[model samples]
Target: MTTTQDFPAMSGSLQEPAPFWRRRTGTVVTSAALVAALFGGVTGGVVGALNASGGGVAAVSSPVALNASSTSDVSTIAAKVLPSVVQVNVRSGQGEGLGSGVVLTPDGRILTNNHVVAGAQQVTVTLSDGRTVDAAVLGADASSDLAVVQASGVSGLTPAKFGDSDRVKIGDQVVAIGSPEGLQGTVTSGIVSALDRTVTVPGTSTGRRDSSVSYQAIQTDASINPGNSGGPLVNAAGEVVGINSAIYSPASDGGQAGSVGIGFAIPSDQVQQIVNRLS
Candidate 1:
């Protein structure tokens, strides 16, 4: 029962909605089961029981101080946006994963990559203020690797301002925030390396039925990793232009992974559609 309040969502979405499976269980059962699986066992029960009676979890409010030449107003942007950013943790029988997400509405609607929360029996979202809350999967589209989750018993949440990803060009600076390698609230900065690039994402049984979707991505040099998926890719203006999705690891080392100064993000225009549908 080691309860990690904040987990990060990674990856991003692509154009054209892909078909996905819907969980049949009611939101209550699914959420309860998720919490139980994570905090009910002997290892988890102690923390779960403690938190269950210890009132609600506190939220993290401190924002990361980002430094970039073009971001002279970085403090204003970070302060305005940090409240909407959240750390997501997904747990299943096998193990747990981490990623990041954006709160889409004041009522606690959040958007993140389907791959980040895929196969998760339970999901918990931690706000920037250190408050931890249970989340429910509203809908997930695996083909696009996008999913929407909602948090309960939380209010006054800030939503991220969306930017035009289509207008983003190569060489523009971008920032990413997520829990890389389980280290929560990590931030990295880089420039858009490429645009409208297409890459193939290996299919998952739990992913969209389309088998694969070609992405119109914003390539960057940001240090994206397993836990950085589903996080926001912000432009120099501090607007969310893309969602951090994947990185290209050279095939040289027998598929051993390494950053080659290349990473990709799902364009924001496409994300609007999904978020609108969820809202």
Candidate 2:
């Protein structure tokens, strides 16, 4: 039996998936562990959706100005995409946890994993300019593992350019950006190893045993870890194609699950649809 466990949620629940599909030959494993990439020790506080607009993603900034011939340039892509990504910090009754978010609109609306801000009492985000600002949860959907948060009174922010996930092909170069282990502005690069991978992760709410979220994921080899949840996985054109969500870990890793070159992301096309519903 293949074993899959979600990265540590704030509650540290051990979630298992339905069944494992054998795609690679000679890759025999008795169990597969899928862990939530969001932090575990720090739980988020609960918040209601404040007044937010369901405005579509803005085409602000020039984050897609890479050379057409070379979409795999990490340095160029990182510099352009970094500003649109932010570090999300949550404080709750249990403790404080940190994750990552992608800016959706210029007026401070952000997109991140629902688990990142789930159960959070207070939420704040640090922009790439090193400015930290208070934010509020606009809405969260545990079913889709997506959420929308808005930074208070913020403007002139750079929104990420979302790409067409449907057009993402296997082996295409991609970049992952987020704060892992509280290290903000971290960047990692890899290729899209697979597509339409089914990933199921537990919700962030406490005391709900049946609370879980499942979605078809874009699998990549990027180095994703705890606190990298909700960060953007962009294509070579600096377009956000997916949101880094979960990773596969060997059962023997002893709970110290880091990226093993098999990370999964929520496709950006789904992200845009959910953000619209939440916002």
RMSD, one per candidate, in order: 13.8, 11.7
| Alpha-carbon TM-score of each model against the true structure | 0.71, 0.76
lDDT (10s digit) by residue, model 1, range 213-256: 44556667766654556778776566788776655433221211
Off by over 4 Å in 2: 1-37, 40-72, 206-209
Worst 10 residues of 1 by lDDT: 40-49
- What is candidate 2's lDDT per residue for 16-61, written digit by digit as tens? 2111111223211212233333542321111111012211010000
Candidate 1 ranges with C-alpha deviation above 4 Å:
1-76, 205-210, 252-258
Error of 2 at 8 (Å): 22
lDDT top scorer: 2
Question: Candidate 2: RMSD over Cα atoms?
Answer: 11.7
Let me know the TM-score candidate 1 reaches against the reference structure: 0.71
Per TM-score, the best of the predicted structures is: 2
Candidate 2 to truth, TM: 0.76
Give the clash count for model 1: 30
Provide the overall lDDT of each model, using Cα atoms, as 2-decimal numbers. Answer: 0.54, 0.63
